[model samples]
Target: MSKIAVIAGSLYLWLSPGLTMGQRTSGLIGVPDTSFTVHSAYSKAKKTHPDIRIAAPALPPTVQANLNVVYCNQNGRDLHIDAFYPVNQSTNRNQLPAVLLIHGGGWRSGDRSQQIPMAQQLATNGYVAVTAEYRLSTEALYPAAVHDLKAAIRWLRTNAREYNIDPDRIAILGCSAGGQLAALLGTTGNRKELEGTSCHTEQSSAVQAIVDVDGVLAFIHPESGEGDDSRSTSAATYWFGASKTEKPKLWHEASALTYVDKSTPPILFLNSSVDRMHAGRDDMIGKLNALGIYSEVHTFADAPHPFWLFHPWFEPTVSYTVNFLNKVFSKK
Candidate 1:
């Protein structure tokens, strides 16, 4: 058997002894048991995919980075973005594709800096990449973070020429809470209500693709509550300003799954096998497939919720993300 197949088989046996290979194809099986051990499965997968390494590859000499460029001034705060792009223009005069990275902290903490490494890496690989700041739950409520993200999209479009970016070829990538926002940004593109009266209102906030890294899809669905605890539920309550039961409509409205349709952008979901951070992800992928929209899901065996932030898994995460983005952008 191939090395990858052997590693996968070992992972399946170690992680989900109950499920067959066919059953694990969707990448949503094997919710981590509380007593689940870690490191071994990921270590095996790493050994198998040896090409995936932690060190960021050297960039071309022409790559440039600009930090703390203000994208918006909202609620007495100046939202900033760190942009990384290549100085060398494309041969055909066509603008380069852009990517916006959103950081995650359950919509409460975390900052744009969390995604700086990825943004820089993307820029080095011939893309204009940006890491943007948005209002957290501590500063605002539910829709506020969403609005900030949409506004950031608008900001990119409005300043596309300045950054040598193709406005229509923009994609969004987010992890954890940011993943939820990125998913919502992709699904609710045409929804006028979610597009708040923030900066750059004239430009469309729609994205061409979405890369959601372990984000919740449905806030109130039964699957959403499957692996959640009181602390996670409390984070939702804090963000929405009410319990799910107290404001059912708000919770539903905030859910990305509620807005899935034919118009939703193609999505790539990267998740850890044992972590339930992205509850209802498989169902969301199923809905996207039903609508004929493109979707891909890859699960790293025995990985943690924040796998992308560390070594071994981080390399695979970036590889999959760059490949997916390249595929989606090339067709546009």
Candidate 2:
């Protein structure tokens, strides 16, 4: 384990030594309702870049889509996935690789439809692409969303034949809060504790590649601006059910940086110019290098934090993801 991992695992242990096992902490603050939709992001971006516009939600003619398919039923709560694939599927062709897209809304406000445009583009590019819905902080707490996403991955693999997808060639991508979850899913692929009870126990939740778009890798790092509740409750605080000061353990445990090891798959970080958005990223890449794992980073300088939601940046985001997925999945 690295220094960051050590800190991540033990940050609050010494501070709360007398706390009992599985003791539920309470009185944690919550944030006001905030919309994290693509429209909201585009509206915010348009303020700075007037010419930038939102990406169209239409799928290309070459793509076939199956929307609102139930991928998991968690205690009767059904989670859905929207799958997109090539329209002209030939029986003789090889099984297509797949990419599962996760939406970012600070783990509170985003929806699966936010990833629809990107999924469409990926499907048009000869891959089985999907957008998944998970239990957000508003609906549940930390590990619930994690388990939900892992279930989505397993669902993709379990139904691989039906979707013409290669069970082993799946990638996960997320923006902002979704990016954090994507990275966590990638790094903790083998950790049984993080795999919450969902459907498809026989299938694996591991992803072959990860694309983290403008998401923080660590919540407790010096570079991280998370948990700052001076003006309002930060999104990280909202998702974790407590402020970083009050529940450092949850903060550490949720960080993707805490779990990165040699077993971690290749990662591609698509970031904005905002340094805080990519907190703990440099250290993460450093660790990946030492572990002999492949990782890539591309910063869109001066771009809005929600660049993936808008026009000019959206195209390159998809392009980088497609290229990276091809390179990493090709090794299999």
Candidate 3:
């Protein structure tokens, strides 16, 4: 194993406590509602060495990065995607599965650069990974970001041959706000209403699978609780352009839970044990089960909402993600 993989494996063992021998043998480190009690230790360690930076592991020799390729032009703005893929490979008929990674910032702030490491890692593992930029709430409203993502997907399919990508095997992955968008994209596949006239109108915007990390499914549900209050207004209120009471239909329409059906793609949810962070997750999982669509949730014990971005948790997060994608794409 690589050095980072060894570190991550050791960290997982250290972080997991109270696990039965059977559970450990099964490699199920996450248990619902089990709080991770090591936050203070990490906090203290950080304070003692405040300048330390936890960089993501480097990609292997087989992977290569293609940065800032414009995928669409919307309202005169050119949206770009940073792609990563394997080089000089004869595996899988010289075509690899693709993943579109979206970053999280509550729809207000965040950039595609936030997901570069993740895209690189996925590429190192033999998939074509693209991190894309979309309009934020500061620039537009609910469907604009969604439209940009759909355009990205269409662009990937349109240029699959150039990138050695399997056009039909693309999946969507996102964190926090991006997670919400990924869920929406997965559920609203080919829905005419959400397919704004950005670009690539003739191509399909559907994804084959979804990976949501700490994203909200039902924005207006009471279980969602309060989110980052530092802003003058709630993120959802800004994104939807109105309070829930003022535009109930808009709220419902923007929710991923509102569109779930038998056609929805397989989904894998990686989340913190905090109930409010993953509000409506269980409800969506139940719906998927009822429809016989595959869905699973793995909750990290007491970890923070941004666990996927940092060390110790990042590796495990990617591990689960790759395993899930492998399972889903193999079935396809």
Give the alpha carbon lDDT tens digit for every residue of 119-199 in model 1.
877887778999998866555566777888899999999998888889889999998888888898988985798888869
Off by over 4 Å in 3: 1-55, 89-92, 226-231
Ranking by lDDT: 2, 3, 1
Q: Report lDDT (CA) for all predictions.
A: 0.76, 0.84, 0.78
- Model 3, poorest ten-residue lDDT window? 19-28
Candidate 1 residue-wise lDDT at 63: 76
The alpha-carbon deviation from the true structure for residue 114 of candidate 1, after best TM-score superposition, in angstroms, is 0.5
How well does each candidate superpose onto the true structure, as a TM-score? Answer: 0.80, 0.89, 0.82
- Model 3 — TM-score against the truth? 0.82
lDDT: which candidate is best?
2
* Shift in Å, residue 48, candidate 3: 13
lDDT of 3 by residue, 126-184 (tens): 88999999876655566678888999999988988788888789999999888988999
Residue 256's lDDT in candidate 3: 91
Instruction: Report clash pairs, candidate 2.
Output: none
